[model samples]
Target: MVRERKYLGAETNAPVSIICNCCCKRCARKRQRRCLPPEIIFNILLHLPALVIRDVMRHVCREWNLMIRSPYFIHHHLRNSIGGIIIQPLFLAGKSTYVVMRRGCLEISEFDCGFAYAIRTSCNGLTLIPDSRDIYTLYVINPLMKQRTALPPFPHTVDIHSEFKLAFVEASMEYKVVNARGPKPLNPPKQIAMLTIGVDRVWRHIDVQHLPLTARTALTTFPLVTGGYVHWIGETFVLTLSAETETFCEFPMPQLERGFRKFLPMDGNLSVVYCSNELSRDVWEMDSETGEWTMLLSFDLKPLLHRFKDLFSNEKSVTYLGWLAVREVLVLSTICFQRHCIAYNVKTGEIQSFELGTDCSNTKPKVYNFVAHKNSLVCLEGGF
Candidate 1:
């Protein structure tokens, strides 16, 4: 063929052009066949660690950066995310220490916050940390992202064994912080403060006059937030607030004065946990839609608490902190003098204890709190 074309150079040029055109068409077809859909790309990236998404994958290209920060991606990441137990020791717990036990692993990680704040509760990957020096000064921090939002201070001191809460308002699709400052024996804040994240420039004060007189006398330590409402233990009843309507609802909890009763959010419903010195633990679930409370899980902590009795003093107490939903483990803090973390398996009925630290001060605990923490790349309009 070459010998025949050697004498016809002009004819060979057309054949060469035809071959080049056919090669270009084949390359185009290959590119089209190999290109992946956006949905498939999203699913593939979802399995990667949040650190990879924020640091490595996002920087790979502009399209990736946009998708990683998108709302849908953030929402789905949160939905599939697994949370761990975050522990704050009482003494240095206020200032520096944070102990984290991640899910599906036994290894413990501890780090210093490099500041002073009593970490109280976590909701949707953010924690409500109130300053230990000034109880009214509050901050919402995403420890995993190393982002912090210092909320405006309250007008006065919230001194009555206060508990702060971070909750979401479904109607506005915004996060809200509630002071939940329980009443002190001496002075009680006339009005409670509420702040709408990324919306309210300053703290919004709501009067407590409409609330029951007992509301001023006592406030619960644990607050359950679902949708737009936040529920807390009042002096003698359960107090709920609609963050959207700014209205209030009050209901009575089961009358149990002998045990350390705390409110827990469990199984998409509100749960009440009562741990007594009598070595018994009762978990009651309440239908979120209906205000009905039903006793479902009752377990004897004798076998579970017996093995860890050496960790606490004779006057030791057991408090059910919160449930680890993905792991089916109930977090309990056993404290007589020092605090020890005990995880109770709901299915296996087995318990494992963890010490916060090995040092002497770590053994003698203070007013620390433990909450479920999920490391998420939840980008908000607000600074956090």
Candidate 2:
């Protein structure tokens, strides 16, 4: 059936002009009544998939050029997709550090810290630090969003020599920093130090009449989906603190041939990395349910040593490392050696490399540290 066309001003309208096929009989009236302007067209294109929208609107007009470049559009795209992971290069100047977001990648605002030693993410945003110095003075920050909050200092006097690790416990929604120091005293030890975040007060010292320290100790906090927990690694013992109860309990470390140990959080589970007697690298995951350790990945460093002789032999070769799961892939970074970065697809076992340099001109890669958060990837630029 043929229907009469409607026009914007129809009282005395002559035959409506047929401009294009898009202006079919039904749409002809609406088109005549209100022609689609560039703004409307741009908005409609924004709702489409990125590739499809780009392909169709590339020839649409000039107005979209500015709209697409606008921060609103950029942020909208970034927030909707798995945004980019950003790593700031340490020691270089010209080559700026960058972040990879869905819309595209961008550089982080410049800071005076030579290289970031640690990176973290929170509900508020991301935080980067050059090193662990006075725990009392550290501040958490989100570089991309330019937001920051001064973290409360540790409660007790911490040994400046010991290394520290941080984790966020979701159950309590609090952040905790754990420091591992000297072995237990031959004589009875008098005091023990611990730190907690989001507490109204600073760190508080507890008497250690019952706690036994060992030759090699480690402190780490893990964020489990149900709740977060903190662990203290002694030479042969493991102490776990439940975030919900704020109580500590003892557990045993797997009897593995451990020379040196490193800890990381992976897939809501605790991961331990160490060098075996075979001088190969081995990774283990802790099963919270059974409290048993399961070996995940073992690699022959001998092959890597031969291939990257210069890197492996360097005194700066990274010793301590952590892994972050990004889009079903595991990204690893080290601190002992010069900045060495690698990623592995857990399922496929495919490996990729990341290069970090101080400046754009530095062909030699440097090392850095990295951490993943809810919405962003953060890396500490430079060797620690």
Candidate 3:
């Protein structure tokens, strides 16, 4: 007969056979078998999705609880994870909301955040959001684990035009939130406050130099992390912020066709999508080493004319979200008739559409924010 083993360092599949009563007695008299080796357990757990590990496996026992919480496991998990999209709909007047829609899943899991007007970009699976009740107060949250911590309020009133950015610093293994606000983009921000949570609760100002002439233009978009730098797309150039060094570098963007331009993080670099002439679109990738741009794919909305005539008729254009490398599909959103998205296959010219269901009617802002995300065990604790 076989019984469960709980001793550490034990082989997971090895069983001691007791053929006779004497052998059984001797086995029982001897020290109990050691539990499974940590290496073997780690290998087994590494294959499970982050949701399973966070919700199910972590609750199995004390050993598992500690294993999942360990820094080693967390780093590995965050590195290998492929995240879904975090959808935050800006309704007219209702409770602020957040939800995650994993690719290939029809239903979404909602994360409760009390009435908040803005949902900041996510970094390593954690999102920083301003509390609706008090816009000055911020909450850093891991929706998958339902873990959250509030940040100390800003010394001065937080501006509505200010942008919030979350980033993971590898050197210190910490998460930092940057609040950048200014009346114009070309000029340096009036105030740039940064806080490294868990290490210091106080916010400190960052001294930025070599400002871009275009900085005077107000920034309406959030920052994206890729290739070890946090990037913000400006009118003339892309602003790159080093996560480790906390410094800024500017790179010029490829000339566009005078339509719509968007920057998305993909394949470890910045991917740019520019739409022009109302129907023609081009997708390019920037080389991190040489700063060269490469055209990966192009799209013609002519084929979509038959199915999505409403889009072309009303002059509504497509918004490039991100790419699904594993599936080789391009993600895009549109608001021609209503809020919806299209998944266009790169290898094969196939297209599918999905309704985002954001209830844009009667909303004051009438806009929704969407971002590509992956679940990570990047801990919110510890300091640099």
- On TM-score, the candidate that comes out on top is 3
lDDT of 3 by residue, 172-266 (tens): 87777776664454455645667877877688877654464464232335667663566777777777767667777677778775667777787
Each candidate's lDDT (Cα)? 0.64, 0.47, 0.64
Return whichever of 2 and 3 wins on TM-score: 3
TM-score of each: 0.75, 0.54, 0.76
Query: What ranking emerges by lDDT with the best candidate at the front?
Result: 1, 3, 2
Q: Mind sharing the TM-score for model 1? A: 0.75
Residue lDDT tens for model 2, 1-384: 334666532765544453224357668677657867766765565555443434555445566655654545544543443423444443333333333322222223333223234343332134434334544365555454344455555544443422334555555545555443423423333544446654645645555445554412233222222115555556665666554455556667888764767776554466776767444567778754345778787755444445556556631354533343432344444445435555544445555655555445556556443443433212122100
Clash pairs, candidate 1, are none
Evaluated at residue 14, the lDDT of candidate 1 is: 56
TM-score of 3: 0.76
The alpha-carbon deviation from the true structure for residue 274 of candidate 2, after best TM-score superposition, in angstroms, is 3.7
lDDT of 1 at 90: 52
